[model samples]
Every structure is written in structure tokens, then in C-alpha cells.
Target: MPEAGIEPDVVTYNTLIDGCVLTDDSAGAVALFNEMRGRGIAPSAVSYTTLMKAFASSGQPKLAHKVFDEMEKDPRVAVDRAAWNMLVEAYCRLGLLEAAKKVVDEGEGRAAGRGDGKYKRMYVELHSRMFTSRHASQARQDRRRERKRAAEAFKFWLGLPNSYYATDWRLQHDGNLT
Candidate 1:
């Protein structure tokens, strides 16, 4: 990275870290993280999330806790459900039922009650649903319009001269033919 003239930013670091984790290369992830810190690049929520996932998947809960602790110290760090879900699954896989339960409870608490948090979730959900519905309605209207246009085109085609069938007769039973 230092060799390249391109300076490493948070986005670049995050991508490198994600690739390391996907390949189960925890050591590489750690090295890149240290390099990031040395370069004075503050990790964002996405950075922490990727590190947390790497640590958890690599069976290195100790390192995961280190990242989590750092996250807690950084007041601006926003831990999303994906982060919590990673811990929850990790704990469950390790048969740490209590820890898994605690993580789950904490996530639920963050999204709990009929207060502002709940209202915010509700607003997000409602807004997304309404937006989806509007898109679907527009699609339906478009289909209807297309069908109408096709019907109109067929009518015009039928109305053209010499467009009729020469014989419009039904078959008769037995020897009788129409």
C-alpha cells in the first residue's frame, strides 16, 4: 500500500479488510488495521464491523473483544445490528449460550419500546414500504398503458381494409358441412 502512490483512505482500508476476512486471513486483516492506525486513519463503523466479523469468524474472540472495546471508547462509532448479529452467531457457534443471549438482549434493547427508537424504526419501515408500493403502482400503471396501446393497435389493424377472413363458417356434424 505504501508503495502505491494512491493514499489509503477509510474506504480503501475497509475494502482490503473485507477481502481479508472473506478469505479467512485474520493476520492480514490485523496487519492492515495496524497500518491504518499508523497512518492516523481513524476507523469508521464499517471498519470496526469488518474487523469484528473477521475476529469472530477466525475463532479469535479475544481480538473481537479488543475491537469491540475500541468501538465502545469511540463515542462516534455506531454499531449496527450486523455487528451485534455477528457476535450473537459467534457466541452461539462456540456454545456460549449466555453470551449469545446477552448480545441478543442488548440488540433488542437498542430497538426496544414505544419511544423514539421504536418510532424511528417504524418511520423507516413505513417509508420504505410506501416507496415500494408507489414503485409497484407505477409499474402496474405502465403495464396497463402498454396493454391498452397493444389493444388499440390490434383494433386499428382489424379495421384496415381486406383484413377480414374470406369464410367464417362452422363445421356441421356427419355428412353436413357449412
Candidate 2:
């Protein structure tokens, strides 16, 4: 856009934000978003959704929620289920099962569009992430418990007073002990 002497607008920034998010560059996406706002470009749904997805995929669901909240307050930007699903998937990937389920439940209860086959696809993806996160978290917990038990055993041994004694012969001859 700069090369063509066409000033980059909100849409341009949004496109860049999507690219940055896809590449896992949430910071770059945020920077571009701020730059867009600084240039007095009113963000559209595209801008908001792109940023929301960026934050969600970056494991910052709170930030994504903030964007979604603002999107909801602004009548101009339509709140789409995809944005919600992005956040759901993010939370699921982080092992936040409740939050992920909340998103899904909200969508279902609120009559959020089925999006034809897209809703189910997103649901399956989110479910997969939840399972992966749960497995990974459980594995980590098991390893931690094992380490704690080993450490406790080591401590117990170290804390005991050191002593020595004869075995079989001393046991038989009680009078000749010491």
C-alpha cells in the first residue's frame, strides 16, 4: 500500500494483524492494531476479530475476551462465533476446561449460528485441544508427585540420626552386646 501511494487503512492493518497472528506474532499484531488506532482508523469487525484471534491463539484469552467485550459493546462490529471459538480453543489448549465449555455452552444456548459445518469443526478442534492439554497436565502432575515423593524419602533418610549396630551375632548374644 505504501508503494502504491495508497495509504494503508484499517483493513490493511487488519490483514497484517491476521498474518502476524497466523505466524504467532501476537505482539506484532497488537503493535499494528495500536498503530491503526493512532492513525484515527476506526476498527471494524475485521480488525477486532483479527486481534481477538491473535490474542486467543497466543494463549492470552483474557485479552481476547477484552476484545470480544468491546466488539459486543460496539454495534458496528458483529460478534461472530468464530471469535468465540478461537477463545474456546485457546482456553482448551491451556487446560481451562471450564472456560472452554462455557464458550461452547454460551454459543449453543445463545443460538449462535451453527455456521453450517464450521461450528462442529471448531468444536472438534477445541475438544482435541482440551484432551491434549489435559493429558499433558496430568503427566506433569504425575512427574511432580513422583519427584516430591523422592525428595521426601531423601529428606527422611537425611534427617534420621546416624547409628550403627551388629546384626545376626549381636542379636543372639544379648549379654555380650556393645
Strongest candidate by TM-score: 1
Instruction: Give the per-residue lDDT digits (tens) of candidate 1, residues 71-166.
Output: 868887777666776776667667776777676666666667424365346445543433233446777767655554444443332232231235
Global local distance difference test of model 1: 0.70
What lDDT does each candidate get? 0.70, 0.71
TM-score of 1: 0.58
* Clash totals for all candidate models: 0, 0
Candidate 1 residue spans exceeding 4 A from truth: 1-4, 110-178
Q: What is the lDDT of residue 89 in candidate 2?
A: 68
TM-score for candidate 2: 0.57
